[model samples]
Structure formats: C-alpha cells, structure tokens
Target: MIRAFRNEDSEAVVALWLEASLQAHAFVGKGYWESKVEDMRTLYLPLSEIVVDADEATGEITGFAALVEDFLAALFVAPRHQGKGTGTRLLKLAQKMRGTLELSVYAENERAVEFYRKHGFKVVGQGVEEATGHLELTMRFGG
Candidate 1:
C-alpha cells in the first residue's frame, strides 16, 4: 500500500533511492546517479512531501515517490518491486492532490522516460543540469 511518508520511513526511502540509482547507473553513469540522490535531499526533501509504498505482509518499504508543489520530484521503486505498478499508483496519488504535475528526468534514462510517457506525462522542454552534466527533459501531466 502507498501512504504519506513518515519521518520513520526516511531510511527505507533512501535505501530504495540508492537501489534505483544503482540500476540507473548502468546506463546513466555512476556520477549521474550520485548527483540524482544528492538532488533528492537538496531539491526535494526540503519541499516536505513524499509517499512510500509498503509491502502488505512485511511492512517494508518497497518504493517511494515525492512531490514539490505541482512537480513530481522523486519516484523510485525497489529493484525487486519493479513492474509491479507501485510507482504508477504513487504518482496517481500525487496527481489527485495536485491536478497538474511536472518533473525533470535525465534524458538518458529511456526506460524512465517511457514509463512516464505510459502514465500520461509529456515532454515539454529540455535542458542541461550543471551538477551532473546530464541532459534533462521536463515532462508535465494533466491539463
């Protein structure tokens, strides 16, 4: 089940991010993955909104997603939980709270791009991130 993030969930959430980042690193590079995690705390955590997916049986966090205003800031699912729809469910919850949403994603991460697109996100613009020297695409959802 997906629920609002509690302070207690930080450790699990961070772990999920690290795991997802490691998977992303295979294609995006380790430096880019590291910068993404750094951006999570620096750019998203301060915004004070996140949601976590918990395993019903174990109660262990399986994934997490966060939002800042109308922007979807972070969305990571544990490697073991991928393709199980947890990320999409969390995103739908975020969208329910904010009718519109936007997010920046690394352009090199095609799987993520396709995932977002499958969930109705559309690329609206592109830019370079100074911190990671990676190209980013800005995608938006809703009207």
Candidate 2:
C-alpha cells in the first residue's frame, strides 16, 4: 500500500535508497553513494514530500518516491522488489495526488529514462547537473 512518510520510516527509507542506488547506478562508485547517505537523510528528504510503498503483509517499506512541489525529486525501489511494479505504483500515486509531475534524470540511466517515458513523461530539455557533472534530461508529465 502507498502511504505518507513518517519520521520513523527515515532509516528504512534511507537504507532503501542506498541499496537501490548502488544497484541501478553501478557505473558510479560505491563511495559516492555512501557519501550521500547523510545528505539524503538530513537534507534532501527533509525538504521533499515523501511517500512510501509498504508491503501489506510484512509492513516493510519496499520503495519510496519524493516530490518537491510538483516535481518528482527522487524515487527508489529496493533491489529485491524491482520489476514488481512498486516504483510504478508509487509514481501513479504521485500522479493522482499532484495531477502533474516533472523530474530530471541522468541521461546515461537508460532504464530510468524508459520507465519515465513509459509512464507518459516526455523529455522537454537537457542540461548538466553541477553536483554530479552528469548529463541530465528534464521530463514532464501532464504538461
């Protein structure tokens, strides 16, 4: 089920992000991801509106999506839960709640680009992220 973020869920959510990020962005060094754990916990997450996907039976969080205003700031599904629709479900929930969503994704992350396109987001612009120095595409849904 999809639900609102809880302060209590922070630990599980951060751990999920680390695991999923390490899996999805294997091109990036483990140390890079590890270094961001603190910022993800204290800085980014606190600034976004977060929602989590919880297993109905175990009540464990399997994935989460974060939104800032109408833009999707982040989404991560546990590696064990990949290809199980957890990320898509969380994104659909975001669409229902916000009606429109926008995001920027790494140009090299083909899987994520395909996923967003499959969900009706279209690339509107491209740029480089100063933080990672990675090429990125800006995509938007619902105009």
Candidate 3:
C-alpha cells in the first residue's frame, strides 16, 4: 500500500535509506552515509514531500520516495524488499503527482542510472558532486 509518510515512519525510512545507500553507493565511504543519517531524519525528510510503501498485511514500510517540488530528492527501498517493483511503484506515483520530474544520481551507481533511464528519465547533464567528488548525472523526465 502506498501512503503519506507519518512521523513515526522516520526511523524505518532513515534505516532503509542508509542500508540502500550503503549497498547502491559502495564507491562512497560508509562513514559518509552514516554521517548523513541525522540530516536525513531531521532535515531532508522533513523538508520533502514523502510517500511510503507499506506492507498491506503488516503495515511495515518497505520503501519510500521523497520529492522537493519537481525534483526527486530521494527514493529508497529496504534492502530485503528491493527488485520487487516497489521503487517503480513509488516513481510512478511521483510522476502522477508531478508531470515533470528531475533528479541526480551517482554516476557510479549504474543500477540506479539504468533504472531511471528505463523509467523514461534521460541524462541531461553531468558534474562532480562537490561533497563527495563523485560524478553525478542529472536526469529529467517529462518536460
């Protein structure tokens, strides 16, 4: 089931973000993701429009997407629940909410880059992320 993110979902959401980040962004140091946990919990998540995918039977949050206007700030699924269409479902919901969407993904995270591309997002620009000195690709969908 897809639903709005409640305050109580903070812990689970951040945990999933951390785990997924660690797995998908292996090139980045683990400490970097760990250091951002508090910011994700208190700053980023709070400031974005977030939606969660919950288990229909247990109501456990399995995945989530966060948006700041037309920009997809974050999308993550629990490591255990990935590759099961949850990410696609969340992305479709985001598309329905905003006809145009933009986002940046680490260039080294080929799985993510391919996933976004398969979903109709095209790489429009590229740059080095100052914080991590990693190549980042800017992708756009719709207009």
Candidate 4:
C-alpha cells in the first residue's frame, strides 16, 4: 500500500535511497552516495513531498518516490523490491499528484532512463551534475 511518509520512517527511507542510488549509479563510487546520507535525511526529505509503498502486513517500506513541486526529485526501491512493480506504482502516484513532471536521470543509468521513457517522459536536454560530474538527461512528461 502507498501512503505519506511518516517521521518514524526516516531511517528506512534514507537507507533505501542510499542502496538504490549506489546500485543504479554504480559508475560513481559508493562513497559518493554514502556522502549524501546526511543531506538526504536533513535537507531533502524534510523539504520534499514523499510517498512510500509499504508492505501492508509487515509495514516495511519497499519503495518510495519524492517530488519538489513538478520536479521528480527522487525515487528509489529497495533492492529486494526491484522488478516488483513498486517503482512503477510510486511513479504513477506522483503523476496523479502532479499532472506534468520533470526529472533528471544519469545518462549512464539506462534502466532508469528507459523506465522514465516508458512512462511517457522524453529527454528534453542534457547536462552534467556538478556534484558528481556525471552526465545527466533532463526529461519531462507530457500529459
């Protein structure tokens, strides 16, 4: 089941974000993702709109998606939940909340790029993420 993120979920959400980020952006050193833990917890999550997909029985958070207005800031699914449709469900929930959305994905992360494409987002531009110097594509959803 999907629902708003609760304060008690802080650790799980950050852990999921770190794990997924490291897995999906393996081109970058693991330390790169680890370094963001503090900011992810103190800065990002508190400032964004986040939703989580939880196991109704165990109440374990399996996936989560976040947005800052129309910008898709973050979306991550625990490794165990990958390929389980949890990611797609979270993305669709975000779409329902924001009719049009924009997001950036690492150009080297093909899986994520394709996932966004399959969901009606098209690459509108490309640039480097200053923090990591990784090439990224900016995509936006139409209708």
Candidate 5:
C-alpha cells in the first residue's frame, strides 16, 4: 500500500534510510550518514513530498520516496524488503506524481545508477558533491 508520509512514520523512515544508505553507499563513512539523521528527520523529509510503502497486511513501512519539486531527494527500501519490487513501486508512484523528475546519485553507486537508467532516467550532467567530494551524476526522466 502506497500512501503519504505521516509525522509518526519518521522514525521508521529514517531507520530505513540509514540502513539503505549504509548498504548502497558503502563509500561514504557511516558517521556521515548517522550525522545526517537529524537533518533528514527535521529538514529534508519535512521539505519534501514523501510517500511510503506499507505492507498491506502488517502495515509496516517497507519503502519510501521523497520528492522536492521535480527532484527525487530520496528513495529507500528496507534491506530485507529490497529486490521485491518495493523500490520500483515507490519510484513509479513518484513518477506518476511528478511527470518530470530529476535526481542526483553518487557515481560510485553503480547499482543505483543502473537502476535509474533501467527506469528510463538518463545522466544529464555530472559534478563533484562538495560535501563529500564524491562524483555525483544528475539524472533526469520525462524531461
């Protein structure tokens, strides 16, 4: 079940983000992701339009996608729930909500970059992310 994010879901969503980030972004130090938890909870999540995927039977959040304007600020799935189409479902919802979407992904995260490419997103630009000095690719879809 896909639905809008609620304030009460913050903890679960943040945890999911951390877990997914650690798994997908192994190049980034763990401390960096940990340090951003508060910001994700209070700043980024609040500033974006977020949608979560809840288990139909258990109602536990399995994945989520956050969009700020046309940019996909975040998309994460619980590790245990990944490879089960949860991420794809969340992305489809984001696309339906915003016809044209843009997102920045770390160039080193090949799995994620390929996922976006498989979903019809194209790398429109690339640059270094000043915060981490990591090469980041800007991808776009339907635009």
Candidate 6:
C-alpha cells in the first residue's frame, strides 16, 4: 500500500535505500552506495511532500516517492519490488496535482531517463552537480 512516511518507518526506508542503491549503482565504482545513501538521506529528509510504499503483508517499506512543489524530487523502488507498477503509480499521483512537473535525473541513469521519457518528460537542460560530480539532466513535463 502507498502512504505517507512515518517516523516508525525510518529504518525500513534506509534499508530500502541500501538495497535499491546497491542494485542501481552496481556497475559504478566501489563506495558509491554509501555516498548515495548519505546524499539521499540529506536531500529528502526535510521534504514535507513525501510518500512511501509499504508492503502490506510485511509492513516493510518497498519504495518511496516525493514531490517538492511541481518537481517530482525522488522516486525509488526496491529491486525486488520494481517492474511491478509502483513507480508508475507514484508518478501518476504526482502528475495529478502538478501541472508543470520537473525533475533532475542523473545522466548515467538510463533506466530512469527512459522511464521519465516514456511518461512524457523531455530533456530541457543539463549540468553537472558540483557536490556529487553527477551529471544532471533536467526534464520538464508540460508542453
């Protein structure tokens, strides 16, 4: 089930992060997972418009998605739970409320780039994020 993130779910959310981050960055160099975890925690913690997906049976956090105004900030699903429509559901939820949606995705993350494109976002700008040296692709949803 999808719901708001609660304090009780912090550790599970972290676990979801570690699991999904490892899978997503497996081809990257070593220590990438740790650095990403730290970066993500700091980036999303203070955001008020965040939603977490929980596995109804286990009550474990299976994924998470967040919206910062018109920007869809972060959407992640655990490796095991991916390809099961969770990400799409979250994306649709974000679209229902935001007219001019936007997001910054890592240039190297082709999976996410394709996903966003399939959902109608187009690359409108690009730059390197100084803090992480990650190439960022800025995408927009509105015409």
Residue 57 error for model 2, in Å? Answer: 1.4
Model 6 agreement with the true structure over 1-143: per-residue lDDT tens digits: 88888877766776787787677655555486676666566666566477888879988787887788888877789898899999888787777768789999888889999999999999999998786688889999984
TM agreement with the true structure for every prediction: 0.88, 0.96, 0.98, 0.98, 0.98, 0.85
For TM-score, the strongest prediction is 3
The alpha-carbon lDDT assigned to residue 127 of candidate 5 equals 100
- The list of candidate 2 runs beyond 4 A from truth reads none
True lDDT of residue 44, candidate 1:
60
lDDT of 4 by residue, 1-143 (tens): 99999999999999999988889999999998899999999999999999999999999999999999999999999988999999999999999899999999999999999999999999999999999999999999965
Name the top lDDT candidate: 3
Q: Worst 10-residue stretch by lDDT in candidate 1? A: 39-48
Clashing pairs in model 1?
Answer: none
lDDT of 3 by residue, 14-122 (tens): 9999999999998999999999999999999989999999999998899999999999999999989999999999999999999999999999999999999999999
Model 3 whole-model lDDT (C-alpha atoms): 0.96
lDDT of 2 by residue, 47-88 (tens): 999999999999999999999999999999999999999999
Better of 1 and 6 by TM-score: 1
Which of candidates 2 and 3 reaches a greater TM-score? 3
Q: What is the lDDT of candidate 4?
A: 0.94
Model 6 segments more than 4 A misplaced: 27-32, 36-43
* Comparison by lDDT, 2 against 4, better one: 4
- Which portions of model 5 miss their true places by more than 4 Å? none
- Candidate 1: residue 86 lDDT (0-100): 88
